[model samples]
Target: MDAIDPVVGFFGLGLVAGMLRSDLKLSSGLYDTLTIYLLIAIGLKGGFELASRDVTALMLPTIVIVAASAVTPMVAYQVLLRLGRLPHPDAASISAHYGSVSVVTFAVGASYLGRQGLDYDGYMSVFLVFLEFPALTGR
Candidate 1:
């Protein structure tokens, strides 16, 4: 109930962006630009974090979590497409984004938390890499 605004915004944005289906539309390009910015920003920030992290303590769990994040979307996409009757490509694309909490959000939240004097656990930084394992590999 508290999380419905963003969901509704997504549906509204999708509909507005869906208006032109003739292979290419103005809104489609805008959508693509927005998506690309999201992907690039997330990747760049994650790369920065990895660069600044201590490798010795981070190596093992980092490897496992990353693997999990990579695999979860495939399983999720399959489940959504098969059991949920979603179109394959569409399901996969959406599942990939949803399977992991966005790194961008985490980065911003961490910064705000820091400003508010909250110290975070070290392991939480690498948590995303391991998220897929539980969602995709667990019961």
Candidate 2:
């Protein structure tokens, strides 16, 4: 999909860097700064999109999103352990990475849909925020 171009491009850049044994690395402070900036930007966007919407409309979807987020990592862990035969810690780590929602992907998809003149709800961003935490914690 057109939405995945940036993701693929970045992945290619990282792969090339690794293959070349490049010395490029992000400092801890810089990493932390970028992480905070991205998180705040996404949160602010989602918050503004959600501010005027009805809370009652979001309640059921929020419950479902949280529940699915809690369950997905467990299922992924089991599959990685049993089928892939990965070590427990490796399986768990991979599952956690796979299970978490990618907010960047959501933003890109939303942008693509907008460009294509498709309609979607603003509450979907709220759902993306909802789907972030429980997957990593396996709560």
Over 28-115, each residue of candidate 2 has an lDDT whose tens digit, in order, gives: 9997996687668767877887897888888988998888887888899999999999999999999888678776567667766777
Candidate 1 — number of clashing residue pairs? 3
Reference-based lDDT, each prediction: 0.64, 0.78
Score residue 35 of candidate 2 by CA lDDT.
Answer: 68
For residue 48, model 1's alpha carbon misses the true position, in angstroms, by 8.4
Error of 2 at 20 (Å): 8.8
* Colliding residue pairs in candidate 2: none
For residue 29, what is the lDDT in candidate 2? 100
Candidate 1 residues 1-139, lDDT tens each? Answer: 3333443455456567678543434587897887677556655655677777787877787777777676777788888899999887789778877676754466556556656679766346546535644455644
TM-score of each model, paired residue for residue: 0.48, 0.69
TM-score of 1: 0.48
